[model samples]
Target: MDPVDSSAKSTPGSNGSNSASSLPGVASPPERSNSQSNKPSHIAAHRQSFAENQRYPPPSPHAHRHPSFTQQAIQDLLINPPSNRHANTRYAGRDWRDMALSELVPDEAKWADLDTSVEEATMTLLKNNTSNVVLIRKTSDSKTAISTFDPSDLNAYLLVVVGLAKPNEEHVAAYDEISKKAQSQTPISLREIQTLSRKEQLVVLPADSTLDGAIEAFGSGIHRILVTNQSREVTGVLNQLRLLEFFWNEAANFPVIDRLYGSLLRDLQIGTQQIIAINADAPLADALSLMSNEGLTSVAVVDHGLNVVGNISTADVRHLTNTTSLPLLKSSCMHFISVILSERGVERGRDSFPVFYVNPYSTLAHTVAKLVATNSHRMWVVESASPSPSAPATPLLQASHPVPTPAAAAAVGATSPPAPTILIPPTTSTSGPQSPLPGQSIAVVPSAALPGSRISGRLTGVVSLTDILNLFAKSSGLNPSDPSEQRARRRRSSSSSVRPTIEGGRTSVDIRR
Candidate 1:
């Protein structure tokens, strides 16, 4: 496969060579800093907590038994949902239903111009502590974005450029020495980045749209909706995580859904047991390639012994933009993880790499809390297994040759929009796994299990933000499984797609080196 051609040829649908100098409302880019000490202390704290395996104790069984009137009112609102105009009326007429999405804009939201460099955008994400940077055109009056550039996009770019640039070279030699020489700094613009990105149109909701409308959008399988003001200028982004975080923080006010928080994941049938893992000893490039080809955001990192030691995410790919971190792509996933931790200040006393995992018995509320606290998108579901030491470690799927990462390969077709027509899959639907894993299905060597304990058992499954938000959608009468009721409740959104279609059994290809 050819390396990504970053020449000035215009990508389809992009405005040609628009300069970013005069874009209104575009924030000045932060100064480039290579100093490790300049990184945010809070980010370090969050990563440190994750590295330590901070687990939340489940709420007391009686925690929701007796609720205040306001709590009951909120619960009643959810259980017996009020009409669109009155959605928030039950909670003492707070008018949340009438409230505009503008009010929910996060303070740290970041934006970029199409002319912004990939390296600059990468720095913006790290310095601002944000996941995505909305890319807008320089000449447009309205802050309409062409696409959102994220860490995953950066990862896809680098993998194509560095990892797969020389396919004929030995894997060890190609990966180990590619970054050692002085590399040319190509100023790849955000416009080109969008051309190569997953072609999902931005889902925009007018800022004046009601909270209830926003809820419905999320329920309809739209992972994120851009909140644009009256001028059609992008102001904020609303996603499943922020919405769920709001619910969690205000649990006291919403009694109906609050009671469900204490239910164990197993009881609720929440999360999918289908998981994808990579050997810690494998090259980091292999993990990146695995995620790229599979359309995954994260993958669990396990040791040769089949014990999940930690996790490596496409988000971690952002760190590679720096000179100090890029060379590690050729290194083992385990070593790359260590450098990542050291940069985050978690290497102070930690020897073992940490992973975000939960047992099947963990409560929904606790899992949500950890996700919010750590700003993580997914958690592994593991169960204790005392595999005989002699039992060979779980085997990896093998391939005899090299496969191109998304960046190096020909443009794949755009994924379909979320379908508003189908019933949401039951939380435990047996849709075949999306990516490769150790053996068929998660190796669920179920031994004695403890709910909140930190045992690195065999990987069973994963729970994600999408899973939890879908539950909320179900409660709000959006994703009823019954065909009759589903038809009645079906309200199509321009941006919705069924989750199962995305994860439906694609053959798993091994990307391990």
Candidate 2:
């Protein structure tokens, strides 16, 4: 991982032979046409001057194109920064891509004893405003070993208790039974939690490990990693969201990366269109089951016309940790999402819960900002159903009449009486990993609109923090898709492992299958 030589100069020969390919780690350019040789010397030189700047077309969707950041590309970028970059910003000389993980501050580690009751753990989550708690075994004197648990675990536990207690007097009896169990001080066992929903693997890394290394770990399906000190004591927790936020906050310091912020998400090939979603009218229990079965953090909530209204996330399950909210499981998915949003508003001292979505044409910088602003892990991709296919689609936020915030809706209610309709082409079928693909039909108006808001779009796809981190890793000249190779190379190149063992042993976990 040497910095590329920015001073090198090379010319493409008359036959279009790329001289720069002779340099170490540079790929050969594609062949050129004979017509280029017919041009005048000045024009030919002018064309050749920008030859190395041209990028190869991205691989086809089915093509097995291994991602590689060539030295030549790095050199070109260093020599000439992208035109979109902010001109007054000064370069820091050192590449932020190679910045150590310890440089970026992480949230303080939160833990609970394994013997702690489920009710107590719920209180920890609420009080700390954290989504998860690490459970550790404890003796009379000290704590040992660790396992992760979150709101989803509580939901899973309640589902089991409620299902078994069903119809002794309808769901009411089951609800009461769950309430009684929730109030009990029964210990949360590691064995029982392990048997429940598949948990996201938690790994440990030394505080000195590079941010790019963490990116590789996350790309390999790890949700978070614990940062440990010299004594192997857990100091803080680092996750994809925090890592992304760090990059966004310091974009100007890293001019090389800052220039890429303006690229459209579609052009960057950064998101997935294969969305897993639930109908708004379906029972909340079904959505929970879908998430646990699919090992997902959240699922999009779509209306009958397949238009996205909101989402159901495991994080939202925290609101249901209490006995009072347990019965929400039997409620419609839409109502359940509404309840979660309302509760979140109360906690945050605001009543604004707008739908989170992005258009395909959104800039990567804008997408990351939205994720950080909303404190969300994923954004639903929504697209307008325009009457003319060739016409440009304007994003909801960029429109002349932007969707009003909750507070402003009342002020403008008189002028705009009719609700703005969110249009989606009618679909006779559904689409998702667990459902059939949707078929095209005539445009259909949404019947179940979101309460107190006017916004319109059809759900098209999803993009997550992991996808964004993978892009960061790739841009930093690390291939995140192959974590093993990256780790192996890192080990061979460095004197020791990222987490070196001292008097206390290095603590790390690799539970990914």
Candidate 3:
């Protein structure tokens, strides 16, 4: 196959070209001091001779008064560019000129053997501050077992899997029911939690793979990919969040719109239209149900007045699941949140749950920096004032509430005005949250709180890895309005073609290498 043309044409100012005078809209640069002309005649003559002897012919006298050929060429390319003959070969080969996966993957990656239980594996992930674990399954005889296990093994001993304490809704619900039924019984075994061994396939690439390949892998839709050695031994794992973080860190290098620098959290379309939040008084079961039904990884916990109190996430849930005395699914979310916060020394009056958040008017750069610094997947985009004390708190989703259909939401005006929809895999049911009761409101609360008083600010929306990726897509010229470009963007954003499957009460993520 012909090598892919990965070259990117540099813009005028980008290539150390002081072509301000040649640019269409830019003002010409100030004239240099004539003191240089006072240099010795010998030095001036030597410089002139050097310029004349250069391989390229000297510019015409009119070049100083008009656009140079190079500038005109650039303008022509910008106005009506030549089609790339090798457009089809964009990702045909691994030639990511300067960027590499090594620049993205962290140095301290955690590894585990197949014998490691889910609890141990999750703790390892938490300790290592990573979202994934590399599973090394030893094999004495490669041929027979490799064929018996998976045809695509490629003699690799290591595999990667996300650290989910409970892989699926079914498992969580079943475990909850069992725990409640047998309250006096012994705790569940650690083995009950799904481990890396359960995953059907692993996404792996050689350590020297290009960032373009990594981007392609992530765009294909898998959450993370494992870097392997020549022997197929795991080296590190690159997560979707990390990829976004990398992009944010290197945003200056990428082609970005001028408006991006001036854009704020509110300016960019981010977060859910209606923030799907839960009452602190609600049962943990309710939170889990909402998460499963809404296809959310985290949910805000609010007070009686719809003021934000705390946040609960998959990580919190995972830790809760491992405890010997797992809280009853019906237990209050506040109790769980309080316990977690206390354990982490996350005092009240401070930011609840150490959750990172930003004001609506905050710049995109500030938001991106916060996300990177916190190593967080999402940040709450909050307002400057808390909900009024007199106002009733937002209604929490109840088991009794029927899932709302689009018609119902439209009739009640519970839904926000429709925005540009990104084509991610459907996370929630076809019929999502129900319309609020006639007078019900969706008031938010401060993500952070003061000890004695209600804090200013209300939760508005969230900016997540998904949103950042969408922004990157738009800024990079993948027009969201174009169907072909949209499809290409989606194809490049996901790492997996097949979604995770649940079988025999265990969820197995199928990742393609």
Candidate 4:
């Protein structure tokens, strides 16, 4: 005070005009006069305001906002070569799973103050390119955090939202009731369901089966194949789409196959060779998430030693969804028993199996005939059980059965008498858990608690399209059997929370999942 250091003493009351904001002992700019009469007053005022701001630090642009990035599977997210942030503690020590929810609602905001942004919401779903996101509807109880993204695979995720309506008791009761209902009353193997519906086939040709033979197999009856050696061990699944993609890209050398035939060979890359093969003992959700992420029809089921066993496909999952059965007799039945005119077989009767099982390693055209001959939806895709989870699945049927001409099964289906229709009783007849068992010990991460030790194969975690459809029926208060249920459910569940968005300029407050 006695002899002021002009740089430090300019502001007597302000302590340390000197920290990082200003260098230690450095003075802030001179204050401006309030007089309006001076010609230079306005400019001085502007400079003073700017200087005042310079003296104090400003808030971060991202302080109130969460930074979002387009990410692949959280494991693949580039943690930082250019930056040093550890993957384990990127955002408040939260893993990618927790980071996803934190972005939707930060902790600082009281429950009511959190108004989720459309921009942030869209970005939150960047990782899930395949599964639908059901938004969390705003409610009196904002404490309900969003359900986590359950992994379907490297490509899929599954979330169940209360679609089309806000939550209510009746909704809970419906799910409770249906879930408790009988799931499997018939001897309906997963195969029967696919056979009864339109069957999808992936083929596997012999290793000696030429590229030309493989191409001929394409578009015939199968969409995929397991290329195997003479002794019948799977080398790789020859994808029709990959061959077609090769043919399409190198069309000059490709033979003039049917354009219709060539199209199936074009690799849309829908299913890649690095198929996410899970241990048969792994969680059902593991298979579910994998297929969901990949958007594939099937997954090769394997054992601990990496040997292929069977494939639990989308067709199997479809069976899980459409468990409710109505009478399915399509044979010319009402007339065959009427006043005996003459016992004549109808053009297309139903008793003889149209398709039978084929080994996954054979030509697909032949597999299709197996599907018809055995009345199967899909053939058994099996490989010998080995000691690891990565082994190729061998189609057991392919190794043992004969792949007859398609005409063999076609002609038989036309001659047999239709079997009598079976009526499915109301769901209350059977007993099961109110919800499909959420897997246990199939830890969110690997269960390496005892590496090289064995685990059982009881984990089943996929939620069927039927499960999705059923959730929709409840929120909308629609009857348990509505067809639009599945469509509406799929649409509403595409977002993370069940909260509705303004669509077609109309706001529908009702939430039906």
Candidate 5:
């Protein structure tokens, strides 16, 4: 898009009637009324002179001064530089919106193999600074051949898994089982390692497509989408983080402030189905299960009343793995909440956790400001009057009070606290797609009362980086759908085929022409 022109100029004959006023049947401005004739002649002449002066202001009497040599050089360097002209693309001149997903995603060859062991995959993720791994398996289906398929009849079907972060109960158990077999001199099979990895459906788009399509795909609940070449071979993958980086780094190009101002959270399309939450009293295993199963980065923890008390995120899981044993995954969610709250110096009162929330009626500008101040990926939207009056009005963070480090905890004689006991009401049952283990119980909490035991506000929804991109797409007029003509062509060229399941316990990939 071209830069907007700001210089103002007057049209020809704008001060009086011209061709437009002379048009047939065009009415002219009304003449002064007879009552106005009572006004003094000097007063009318003064008014006409004032109007003319206002339209053609007098120029400044001061002479224009030439800039100093240094100032002139600086100005020349900035406006018409003799050097670094090629560096234009290195800065704001480049538009990320026009860039394709393939340009941003890493090469497919760097991805982990489907049969890679848990330990190896974890190491790869840490070394590469990536949380996900593209899992691929060899296939011999001639009908699904691509240009890059190996001549030896070996092609691969791809699935993705969240490979970083702490290992879940199932992953730990699988590792232990495999380790035991290996220690006993028994061989481990590729299938065993693959079974431990939780698979997610891979969304695919063409490599030539713009970022607008990527925003729409992510807004549709996809965590990442694999970019493919014209021959149907995987090229790269675009995830939420990369998309967010593009949005934030190119924020100046977007009119988010103007478009989102005064808009409510509900206008962003948030709903219960999009919320990934766990009961406060539930086990850490349950939270891990939810994250792994859904490929989520965080899960909200709520109380028996369904009020949001805190959040357990992948960062928290990483901290746990670095500081504690893997078995701690079996601990209750309340224990994790306490650890986080205590570390943050949040006192137990009407609200058990130090959660940041905004009202549903809050303006988008307010939300964006809070997001920038907190440096948070997402924030909870709650109803007004959620926190009880008895709850202490502690700020989100105190500058004077330092968070306790490991050494500080030891210096203060603080040790790992025991897990909190929860009394589960019989009426409460397991929530989400995962089922609770036998002998385990869960408390049922209403949506309005889930965050805390106190009379807190209900969790309406959440807003994230993806929502921001959606707003940008709308404001920039980048419609996220194929043209009607292209859609008809695609529909005519499309073929319906069911691809075989790449892995034993994984979902089958649905291939389309």
Candidate 6:
């Protein structure tokens, strides 16, 4: 098929170029998957200690048994003192940590010792509104009173001083070491992102394409869609959310259908923004900024002609650099890739190359589930000739791929790795015929630069978030052998291959390479 013609223009309804950025529940109709796991109220492995034990115990080991004594010991001792013991029961009125000093020591005056009975000490404390026994003990020969609670710090009425006494120096050092270790333990990248890439094919649908028509063309249970022009260029993004917005807000408020749909489309304009682009020379920082800001799970990479040479997404960048430290921010956007798309061109990539493709229409629900299962934001929409989109939405259907359980994960090892979604499929054409992998940068180019630019020859890979992070942000020491590591690993890499299955949907993802 001809490479994506970025020059194709969008209609007025699109966000700018993306006209179908809509939701399902919000707008027009359609529908619906799943694992067998039941949703429980709480799924913790162990029980909670504080579930019923509501009282706070003291540091004393036997405090729980003598609860009554702990609560009212000072009261009894003060009211009725022993003959020989010094009655200082008034000291129990409140702990020093919970007292207000301003109310206790107003004007310094001659203080009596706390060597009297509880009743007498209580009267003196109440008279001065002071409950501090330390005051009576400290005399002219005692140490200085430089250690005082600052009133400003007690604005909350209660002050909890943790680590009141100096902690062990060794313990403090260990704590610091632990904190440093956790912050720096990032995932490491081993595979080249360009090794995994794929493409999506979208058909031009007439405004009147029936709900069933969309399903048959794409798959059974579809939600989000990308609207394109006659030439198959992206015009807008359409999904249940956009449709729901129109259904409840825009379309609902209007009395007529024409104005309602029009208003809804205008409001959710998805075309205004330019697709994110980055050159092969840019740093890894640029890709991070785009993902963090634009929230793009995967971004398309284009060269000077606005052509889609290759796509460098989050996964690609991850595999390029090491997230364990910091991303590589070298020269221009071109120098950014953690793992470069083969620098020697497609000739050197004969044994390995990136490929692009969408999930099969028959198992889209499973594909979407995989996307959701791993928090993957990318999936391809291919121009498949198979499976008609004529069925209605079936919400009860399970959208997961038919894969064995975790117990079977071991078998994947003995078997050959599954085919991956590589942008530049393996082909022995190292001759002068010339097939250069696309310039692999994970940022979108401006719309103005797309027209007439040759993106087809830029690169041949479309990397995912996991790939990029693994390469650029990951640390060493992490396990690198995952059966699922064939290509589709995302956000985080695993030691095993995964066939993620969404509950329902038509969009399926394939990791090329």
Candidate with the greatest lDDT versus the true structure:
2
If the candidates were sorted by their TM-score against the true structure, best first, what order would they fall in?
A: 2, 1, 3, 5, 4, 6
lDDT of 5 by residue, 1-513 (tens): 211111112223244343333433333335557876778888776646667656644332122212235676686454422321122244345555676767667664334443443333333433444424433444422212111111010000001112223345556766566556533434333345554433434677888887767876665445567777888777566776566654544444444424455567667554232354676557676676555444455666655434566667654543232212233355566555555544333223332334456666666656665555544557776664344223232112111232333332343463544332111111122131221111111111122232432323555567775566556555666654422222133121212322334236232322110
TM-score of 2: 0.59
- Tell me, what's the RMSD of every candidate? 25.9, 20.0, 20.3, 30.3, 18.8, 36.8
Candidate 6 local lDDT, 1-513, one digit each (tens): 212222122333333542122311112212211231443546433454784333542232222222324436566455333323232344333322222222222233223232322122222333432212112222344322211111111110010111111223544553343234324432111111111112122233433333333323222222234443444433333433223222222222322221222222113221111224554334445544444233344554433322233444543332221111122333233333212433322336322222322222213223223343333444332232222133311101112122222212332444543322111111222121221112222221222222232213322222232222222111221332331222222222322223232224222221211
| Global CA lDDT computed for model 1 | 0.54
Going through the candidates in the order shown, the clash numbers are: 5, 1, 13, 69, 13, 139
Give the TM-score (vs. native) of candidate 1: 0.59
What's the lDDT for all of these models? Answer: 0.54, 0.55, 0.45, 0.29, 0.45, 0.28
Residue 111 in model 4: lDDT: 20
TM-score of 3: 0.49
Residue lDDT tens for model 1, 326-382: 445666775555545444433244333354777777778778777887678788877
- The sequence of per-residue lDDT tens digits that candidate 2 reaches over residues 384-481 is 74332222221112122222223224324555333221111112211211100010011111212223443446666677887887777778787777
Residue-level lDDT for 68 in candidate 1: 27
Candidate 1 positional error at 440, Å: 40
Question: How far out, in Å, is residue 374 in model 5?
Answer: 7.6
Off by over 4 Å in 4: 1-158, 161-272, 318-513
What TM-score, over all chains together, does every model reach?
A: 0.59, 0.59, 0.49, 0.21, 0.47, 0.21
**Model 3 per-residue lDDT at 148:** 13
lDDT of the structure predicted as candidate 4 = 0.29
Candidate 3 stretches with Cα past 4 Å from truth are 1-98, 106-109, 113-115, 129-202, 216-221, 248-262, 292-295, 304-307, 318-331, 346-355, 383-460, 477-513
* Per-residue lDDT of 303 in model 4: 48
